[model samples]
Target chain A: MSTTARRSRLHRQEHLTALAFVALPVIGFLLFTLYPMLFSVYASFTNWNGLTAPVFSGFDNYIAMVQDPYFLESMYNTFFLMLGIPIGLVISLALALAMNRKMRGSTFFRTIYYVPVISSIAAVAILWQWAFNGDFGLINQILALVGIDGPNWLQDTATVKPALIIMAIWKGLGFSMLLYLAALQSVPRHLYEAAALDGAGAWKQFRHITVPMVRPVTFFLVVTSVIGGSQVFVEINIMTPTGGPEFSSATIVWYIWQKAFDNLQMGYASAMSIVLGLMVFLITFIQFRLNRRNQFSID
Target chain B: MSSQRVLPSPPPLKPERNLPDRTSSRAASHTKTRTRPSNSERKHRLGNLIVTIVLSLGAVVMVAPLLWTFSTSLKTREGVFALPPQWIPDPFVWENYLRIWSAGPLLTGIQNSLIVACTVTIVGTLFSALAAFAFAKMRMPFKNVVFLSLLAALMVPFPTLMIPQFTMFASIGWVDTLLPLIVPFIFGNIIMIFFLRQYLNSVPDSIIEAARIDGASFLQIFFRLIFPIIKPAIAAQFILWFMAVWNDYLAPIIYLNSPEVQTLQLVIANFNAQYAIQTDYPLIMAASFVALLPVLIVFIVFQRQIIESIALTGSKG
Candidate 1:
């Protein structure tokens, strides 16, 4: 009876010790993330100037959000930027395939491609800002060599989104290619040989074996790219200081940030943030369902 | 051989030197290529040559802009707009390097960034490892429940929380200071905790149990046994985390108003904003390159580890 009681006491001690080990992070989650999330939900209905108490304004912020032209424009521009996702994926996959082929100096190419990915976004944006200068730009200067005069990229709304998309593809290519290369490595070579023996050509083999095999990585990339694309701010901040002529380059996060800090419209910004959160949640959920269906059919 | 039956996971754990062994064997196969007259072998050789040429061209596209950035930093401010733009600056003005120190709070920004990133990463990593250990190994009440809840917090998105968080910090008067950036992070990063937990789960429970039987306390075991075993994982996560904090702009801009309190990226961004209009392109380029240099150096030194860690994250996820 005494030994049993001692054993129970020792177990309690272990439990408490483990809890102590985890206390800081658990408490931190509460104080930082959970508290702010709860506050955000409450603050969404108020008209807070951030200096004074948030006075509850009900659905006014939500109602105003729908009619806000800046919000709408920023929302449209954000999604438009995501057009780079498919472009980046296709380019990365092709690059991965090329690198996967029997080759020398593959590591050299891998490092070269990943350089842009590792560079700071702010720095890259600043460099690109100069590169997009109408007259003296690197891009236009190169285009001049080909007898083509490139249009001013960032100043005009028409070309601004495309310019951002091209930059995004260039920056993201190496990382995605690396992921795809790793995935390609794991695919059984015998499957390719089997397909070849069955008279399947290179394109047919790629379509049948390679594409399906890399689907998980594709899904991973797509989900992350969308999450990242939704929060695009630094480039827009650096390259197009006023949000690209007509707010053409402003993303949703950039809009929310401007509203909250610049204008001190914390409540209205909170409402928009809640909407963005839901949009992210909904999009991720839908993608998850789509992925499940794809997996089911493949199985 | 890649033909060996693949491990069910950790696919790219294949050594980076996987190619060198094959190259070493090429001396034996030297005769085969020399004697090769077959159409298939010829096609294969041609394909490799074509790929090499194309990838080299791609590499040029990848590197030219960075090279341009470095070159631009050395040009005269007026030379930046010079027609038939100089790929290599004519005079190679070495003055921007000296001028950039006075251009903004570049030195202060570097110091602030170093303090915040170094403290947060060094301390936060320890706390995260501790949390990961507790969740992965120890028997605690509501363990998975607590772990899952912390994971859920990650989904809230910072924009949704930045307002309330800002208010909370402002009430404490942490605005215009580095505390807002450092404090929340030092509590522990959920992503780091998650990855470390995934790493720890691979460790055999038997060894830990054996240690426990020897009467070593949990903290003792963690310090002597766990930390070293997971040192590689910790280092990978540390370097990535440090780079992230250094490159971060959005959070620092939101909190730090004064130039002195701002982080490195923010200071360079301010230079870009303030000086680009003044047509001080060389100074701005110089400052920007300085901000990028630290991470760029880290990447070059730990290139293999960083790439593998990233590749591991993708497959493991």
Candidate 2:
């Protein structure tokens, strides 16, 4: 064969090999992710029960979502659960700050903090369920030691959200703490030395230097945490299988699960899922825009 | 970087007027001191001591639940809910741990979880690395578009597709089997591919070209050269993906209904439901502790790589 013919043959082989390399992931993505995503959007506009043929019904499922009290309650519960994000961020940031200094046994403390992050959600939920038990829980027992009667935490509608939020914050604290510590260590030490030389106290140095330097990481944690918090399921599912004493802790995802599987309302659940997906996308987009604007202003 | 530029530098000479400023300067000097100890040094030491104490207290709080889980697992039923809540089990029942085998499908759950986790990790990692190699090094048509679409898949959370995916799997008769859990992952995970691609971007083209000149096929170069170079990152991602699959509850619950085929997480959930109402706290705690043992061991063994992965992702963001 001529040299040019051989070169072209080699090029064809390279292209074929590259396609072969990527073929599995491409196929998997199409079948599992892409097709399902499109089908879900289409499924939202129809009436199907997983057995019978789907009947086209425009705007019906979407309208049903507005009227569904359970859907509204779950939306409320989901947003309410997200209240833990700021609290978690603050606590983790404080822990990161405390551990940022070169102290003895920092590694040990970090490992302690990170243990929960590594533990399975089912296990954590079970442990916290015991911890939040009204009569025999650790929290209540501790409260009783201080002359206070702790309410039925997991059973009470009023305290159920708070109970779940505390567990979430506890589980997620180490992750953000580690991220902040990474960001903290990356901050130029000379800046701190310069500030210290100019008589900046601990609080001032922290406020002026530490906070501003870690803004990017803080933004990252906020966006990712909110996205994660909105999807709270196993914890609530395990702790309150019946949605926590009259659907008080029924999150949006849990509601979707119930609707889709328990009730077998595939079309309606698809509608809710589509709405949720849009909400997540919008939130992430807005955060991106806001961060970009903040960075611009800082510059 | 912009924040650094915006901050005003300290003045060369400033008149110290406030007591706090003097104290701050004294503390700074104390930090700098190597030889003679001063009064400010003592104060600084005291401050460090206070911070250390507070952090240690926080660490205890962080560890209290896991410790309680272990302690409760070893306790008898009565000791579980005893007034004043025993920090250590009185009788230290080894039976609770042993009872997990018969009380529920814990052993089956563990075996199923290991099968799914290990198969998915190995298969997913290999495919992801191959696809990443192609994306990072190989020339191909529509490469950027395909890669971009793959990255776009990250935005599509599982819940959005749960219904249709479930329907699809059920129609194919993959539901109620471990196929639904392991098959999709065997093709490769998007996040794993993305991470490996990022790692491979730093690799030089000249090295691959030299390998090619030495009569190495693309597959050979990838396996012989790129794999070893990115093994650490692949291992980190492997451990993470393993934990995700091991901890996964929703997919397993939705897909696998049989007690024998269910993953460890589902079994624990089932165990909790069956026993929580009866208040079998020791049994529940024992099962949970057992379920968490593998993950905890993996985390401890690969803690550095795990933390580095977190740090890497955070910095990339």
Task: Estimate TM-scores for all models.
Answer: 0.94, 0.93
lDDT of 2 at B101: 92
Candidate 2 C-alpha lDDT tens digits along A39-154: 99999999989778788999999999999999999999999999999999999999998887655677788888999999999999999998898988878887898989999999
Candidate 1 runs further than 4 Å off: A1-6, B1-38
Candidate 2 chain A worst ten-residue window by lDDT: A99-108
lDDT of 1 at A118: 88
Query: All candidates' lDDT scores?
Result: 0.87, 0.87
Model 2 segments beyond 4 Å from truth? Answer: A1-9, A197-199, B1-41
Stretch of 10 with least lDDT, candidate 2 chain B: B11-20
Question: At residue A190, what lDDT does model 2 achieve?
Answer: 90
- Taking the tens digit of each residue's C-alpha lDDT, what string does model 1 give over A1-299? 99999988888988998998899999899999998888999999999999999999999999999899999999999999999999999989999999877668998899999988989999999988888878888889989989899989999989999999988888999999999988887787789989999999999999999999989989989888888888899999889878888898999999999999999999999999998888877778888999999999889
Return the lDDT, model 2, position B243. 95
lDDT of 2 by residue, B117-161 (tens): 999999989999999999999988899999999888877778998
